[model samples]
Target: MTFTLGPRAISAGYQLAAFDQIGSTNAEALARARDGERGPKWFVTTEQTAGRGRRQRAWVMPRGNLASSILEVMDVSPAVAATLGFAAGLSLESALQKLAVEANMRRAEPLKFALKWPNDVLAERQKLTGILLEAEAVAGNRLAVVVGIGTNVVAAPEGTPTPATSLAALGVHVGAEELFKGLAEAWVEFRGIWDNGRGFAGIRKAWLDRAFGVGEPVAIRTGTATIEGTFDTIDETGCLIVRTAEGKRMPITAGEVYFGTAASLGAT
Candidate 1:
């Protein structure tokens, strides 16, 4: 009754690049690729002066947190490039499980962590990490993309909307080097699913399997429009399929999915 958890340690084909502090990894990766240099993996740190989230929001990246970007060469289309964040989310969850940090688990089940639509990794209903992925067209058939991720490994800063948790806070202690190494290894498997032109079907399945609040009531915030509906499921493109009050099922490709009770939703 034994099983292997970790794959044989192999180079993730990443050349480690570090910075004392930087504005952003996606910026650096795109800049490096444009400058005719190979987009190597960068372990960015030092103040994270201008870290950001999806949609240009300021990301609160305190020192001692996990913030880095992996630049990969791909032949993926623009549409698929848009879904790369899903692949990275899947990779992050797998690595955290290995480190004995269950992001997706309940007291009855085993997986408490879940992925928010578009680009967020949640832990205990709080955000443990977030990702920002950007793809740029290269000269020929190649697309240079940077998958930047930030994890609160040590602690989180104050005044944030959501409560943030770290691996250490979850009772799983490890250093930055080990955490990054295992994460890179998991990304290799994710790259396979992406490179095969499979779109987000595989990633969607993996995410749904461990996702929180699926088939439940949810409230979504879409900036202009706020909707409350039953969380039916996610579509092939990783969009949420929710049932609205008017007996219509809607597709939510972009927006925040939040869980709520049917009683509360009835008031909406």
Candidate 2:
């Protein structure tokens, strides 16, 4: 099946650059931005040979999986641009939920999809998708930002920090092409609400509604130390708010989060 942009995305003036294979969609998107391609366009593929997750961790996408990145050139600061990731999470979660319903699997036994703080989508507490945001300065003080989303459609990597799952493993049985179609349209809706950071308040609220592990015990590994606390909420600037044991509300800028049993075990 060929990957294509949804009608809504096309109508919204969003473009697509689908590939049969690629080293990294995010890398390609950024390169285009450097070459003066100022676009709200998507670079997508089914197989990614050299993808990097947060902290330069390898994230190789198998042939059956989906690797997609969207490029946007904006005048917002990188700090404000970072918040766009929240909208990406919301968009992907919305797409997955829509696909689940279309497959008629949710009517009998619903499959829960939740956003993991920062950039991940969890299906039943198992990592199903990983999102990475990268940006570089372009001409006229604008930033070319690429938001990459990779999902396990038919295959999940083994022995990860957090156990991973796939749509096929969960019995959804959808193709990567179909998933991308839904994701493209969903992006249009959520990106509209985001409105380039001016509407982040609404995005934050909706994201929390579909967030995983709020009010649950959490341990965050932030290189220097492990901060253990209960997951509270995300702040206005998109920082993770944790309620420490000492009754202090601590905001974490970035960290590896562990919850439930993993939190108790001090898992990184």
Candidate 3:
């Protein structure tokens, strides 16, 4: 099946560039932006050869996996642009929920999906999708932000810090084409709620509703040190609020996080 944007996305002035295989959708989107392409456009592929996750980690999308990126040029600070990732999280969460339901029709057991702090979506407590945001300064004080989303439709990487899973592994035999359709439509809904960071409060509330590891013991490893604390909440500015044992609330801007038993082991 051909990959295509949903009706709502098309009506919202969002264009799409679907590829059979690409090195990295995020890289392609940013390159387009650098070439003075101001767009609310999507770059997507099922087979991504080279991709990168947060903190410059390699992200591989094998055949049948999904790799998608959307480009949005806006006049917003990098701080504000960072919050847009919450909308991306919500979009994929909504899309995956629908697919999970359809795949588990006659089964008594239902698959659970949740958003991990920062930029990941979890299914059955394992990482299923990774969202990466990259931005570059453009003319007229506008920032070209590319939100990249990679999902494991048929394959999952082995020996990751956080365990990974796939839709096929969970018996959700859906295609990448179908998943992208749901994602594009769902993005239209949540992106409207985001409103270019103006509506982050609404996004924050909704994200917390589907947040994973909240109120659980977790550890965040930053560049200098590792902080072990209870997973508190995400603040208004999208910072993860971790409450230490001393009852101090520490706001972390970026870090690698581990929850439950993984926290105890100090997985990095």
lDDT of candidates 1 onward, in order: 0.71, 0.93, 0.93
Error of 1 at 169 (Å): 2.2
Summarize candidate 1's per-residue lDDT along 189-240 as a digit string, tens digits.
Answer: 8866766347467777787787767777788878877788788887776577
Tens digit per residue, CA lDDT, model 3, 1-268: 9998878989999999999989999999999999998989999999998899998899979999999999999989999999999999999999998988866786688888999999999999999999999999998989999999999999999998888999999989999999999999999999999998889999999999999999999998898799998999999999999999999999999988989976857552
lDDT of 2 at 180: 96
Q: After superposing candidate 3 on the true structure, give the runs of residues whose Cα lies further than 4 Å from its correct spot.
A: none
TM-scores of all models? 0.84, 0.97, 0.98
Off by over 4 Å in 1: 1-12, 38-42, 101-111, 261-268
RMSD vs true structure, all candidates: 5.2, 1.3, 1.1
Q: Write the per-residue lDDT of candidate 2 for residues 162-259, one digit (tens) a residue.
A: 88999998888899999999999999999999998999999999999999999999999999898988999999999999999999999999989999
The better candidate by TM-score, 1 or 2, is 2
Q: Candidate 3, 201: how far from true, in Å?
A: 0.5
Clash count for each candidate, listed in order shown: 8, 0, 0
